[model samples]
Target: MIYYFSGTGNSLHVARQFADRLCEQLSPIVNPVLTHDKSIGLVFPVYSWGIPSVVDNFIRRFFQSAEVRSETPPAYVYALMTCGDDVGYADRVLDNALLSASGRKFDAVFSVQMPNTYVCLPGFDVDSDELCKAKLNRVQARVSEIAELVAARRKDVRRLKRGIFPFAKTYVVRPLFNRFLVTDKYFHVDASKCVSCGRCRKSCPVGNILLIPTTGGQGAEVKEVPKWMSHCSGCLACYHSCPHHAINFGNMTAAKGQYSIMKQLHG
Candidate 1:
């Protein structure tokens, strides 16, 4: 069985590819399900040079559940992490999380470069059309190779792309990012530009957005705008999926480009 957590479709697309190649069933990490499969695979996006909180929490819960702890044969655990550029010791971080929760680390870990979607800070934005195309073009072959290795039950595989200064990025910057930038409070929607569409709410994988109807023009126009809740996956899906680009993360995303993997693939 393969468990996955995707925000804007990158991880989901990659998970689907692996599931097709390996003939495994895919389940969202947020959903609760019990399985005794010998091979357990996890696919998720790397966030803030580490695992997203939602994914982390799910991993803990999934392993500690009464149904999962009593399994007989050990599972061949592995992980596939998708990142914009690099993962920076994220595999180690995930291994540690799994070790702490279930007393066993991932036997194999892989990282794949996906299109850039993080744009909440200065000097960081979505990739250009050429770069996005280049990344997408390579994902299939990479995922295929990974699936072949995984199908062979390859152990001790650590194929990953950890860019320079990995320790600093994972240990130092990740903590700060989790503390400061992972909240939904910074999300802003331009009421004037909003078309009263529910796409923002739909874009959120965790259902952390709400649309409230209010009188806009002389109490005649009831416009529905997005309001964020406390629980956020920090995926920036709301910012990327808005048709009119009305959503912004604080003020940093005002000029950033919006890249959607589904739109890039299908449209």
Candidate 2:
């Protein structure tokens, strides 16, 4: 089985491609319950030079569950991360996290460079259409190579060489990001532009978005507005998937472009 956690369809696209090539079932990591015995593949995007908090929690829970411990571990475990650039020591971090959680490690690790979707901060912006298309083409070729390796059950560890800066970034900055940066307090929806579409609520993997009727008096027709809860994963699904571009993370994302690999390729 291939389990994936995606915010803007980059990892999901990779997961689907892998599933097709391997003839495996594709499962979302949302509230996953692992009961059957089979080789496992995890696909997700890198966040803040580390795994997304949602994926981290899911991995920890899945490995520590009694259902997984009651039987032999998966015959082979592999991980594929999608990133705008390099995954700085994320492969080691994942291996270590798995080993610490369940005394098991990924047999193989890989990464694919996709269009950058993390534009909620300064110094970051979505790639231009031409560049994004080029990157997608490259990702397709890389995924094909990854599928070949996975089919052969290759046990190679593909990680970027780490130095002092990379180590500090991954170990120090990553923890800070998980602790302080993953929240929905800064998200806002423009009332004028919002169409009361529940796409944001549905796109949130953590159910952090709530659609509540706008408060008013005197024959004011009911209209829903999205309110973000505190338990956001900072995956940017609601921001990127908003059909009307009504959602914004503070002032950073208002003018930024939104990207979804599936939409870019198919629509």
Candidate 3:
């Protein structure tokens, strides 16, 4: 089984592609507690130098709730992550989470580059169209190459920007972003552009939104209001799929680039 936690479409897209190619069953991370099917592989994006709370909780509850079965094969754990910049810190976060889960063991871990979406920094710029296209092409090629290795069950170490930098990312960079940037002003919803549509709520892999009934100009009305679950995976599907462009990442995230909801390329 392939379990994926994605915020936008990048990780989900990659997870779907890998599962399709491998002929494996794909499961969304929203249902954290599922019956144990040892044929498991995990794919997600790194956020805040840690596994998104969504993925962390899923692993915790899923493994704990699972019932061992004869048909259930031994879990051969594989992890794939997509990142905006250096990847070392995220790997450490993942390693710690897996260790916390007790029984799960990682056979391999891989990383891939997606556009750096953390635009909350003081001076951030989205890639130019030409540069973006070039990077996309590179990602495509890298994903394909990594897929072949997964299909063949190769065991190789894969990382980016060495190890030390990524280690500092979560501790230094990510913490600052989370404290003053992400939580403060990054995730926002634009009411003016919204048409009272609840599409974002439905598309959310984690069911984070809560639709509420309110009296509007037309009288009694029901609207999808975002009441974010703290366990957000940072997929950004809510931001992208907003038909009215109602979702905003606030001041801190206004200039941040869009993140790919795809998975990583394992070595």
Candidate 4:
């Protein structure tokens, strides 16, 4: 069984392809089903140089709530983490979480580079069309290789991209990033540009968006606009999926680019 968490469709796309190659069932990390399957896999994006809060919470709940099948847990547990660049010890963080929850660490872990979609901060933006295409092209082979390794049930295997200052990036900066930046309070919509299309609400994976009604003027027609609840997974799907580029994370995203898996495949 493979469980996944995705936003902007990158991890989901990878998870679907990985599952197909291995002939394994795929499920969301949220609302995870209890499984007696021998091999359990996790596919998700590495956010803020670590696992996203949503993924972390899912690990806590899903592993802690389930009863162990035996003295040892699943025979082989693996993880495939997608990222814009490097994962910076995110695999270690995940292993730590799994160890705490189930007293077992990942047997195999891998990270693959994907198109950049983390554009909510300065010095971070979406990749160029050429780079995006390159990353997407490279990912297929990497995922296939990972799937093959997982199928073989490789143990003690760790293939990660831990960039400069890995310790500082994961331990110090990640906590700060998740604490401050991984939030929905910074999100808002440009009502004029929104057009009340409900695209943002539909794209949100966590159902954190609501379409609220508002009037244009006195006695004017009321239209529903996107409003964000505070339960965001920090995936930026709403921002990247908007056709009109109407969504913004505070004022930081106005000049940033948007990219999604569907856009790469079809756009």
Q: What is the TM-score of each candidate against the true structure?
A: 0.97, 0.91, 0.76, 0.96
The lDDT-based order of candidates, best leading, equals 1, 4, 2, 3
Task: Note the Cα lDDT for every prediction shown.
Answer: 0.90, 0.83, 0.63, 0.87
Better of 2 and 3 by TM-score: 2
Candidate 2, which ten residues in sequence have the lowest lDDT sum?
156-165
> Model 1 misses residue 67 by how many Å?
3.2
lDDT of 1 by residue, 128-183 (tens): 88888899999999999999899988999999999999999999999999999999
Q: Return the lDDT, model 2, position 133.
A: 88
Better of 3 and 4 by TM-score: 4
Candidate topping lDDT: 1
The runs of at least 3 residues in candidate 1 whose Cα sits more than 4 Å from the true structure, single-residue gaps closed, are none
User: 128-167 in candidate 3: lDDT tens per residue?
Assistant: 5555555556766676776777777765455444346655
Could you give candidate 2's per-residue lDDT for residues 1-267 as a string of tens digits? 888998878898889888888898888898764646467889999998888878888888888877675666456789999988768888878887788778878889988888888897788888888888888888767888888888888876674424357787798888887776677888998876788989899988778889998844667667898999888888898998888898999898888898877677876
Q: Report the poorest 10 consecutive residues by lDDT, candidate 4.
A: 65-74
lDDT of 2 at 67: 67
The alpha-carbon deviation from the true structure for residue 18 of candidate 2, after best TM-score superposition, in angstroms, is 0.4
| Pick by TM-score: 2 or 4, better one | 4
**Please, what's the RMSD in Å of model 2?**
2.3
Off by over 4 Å in 4: 69-73
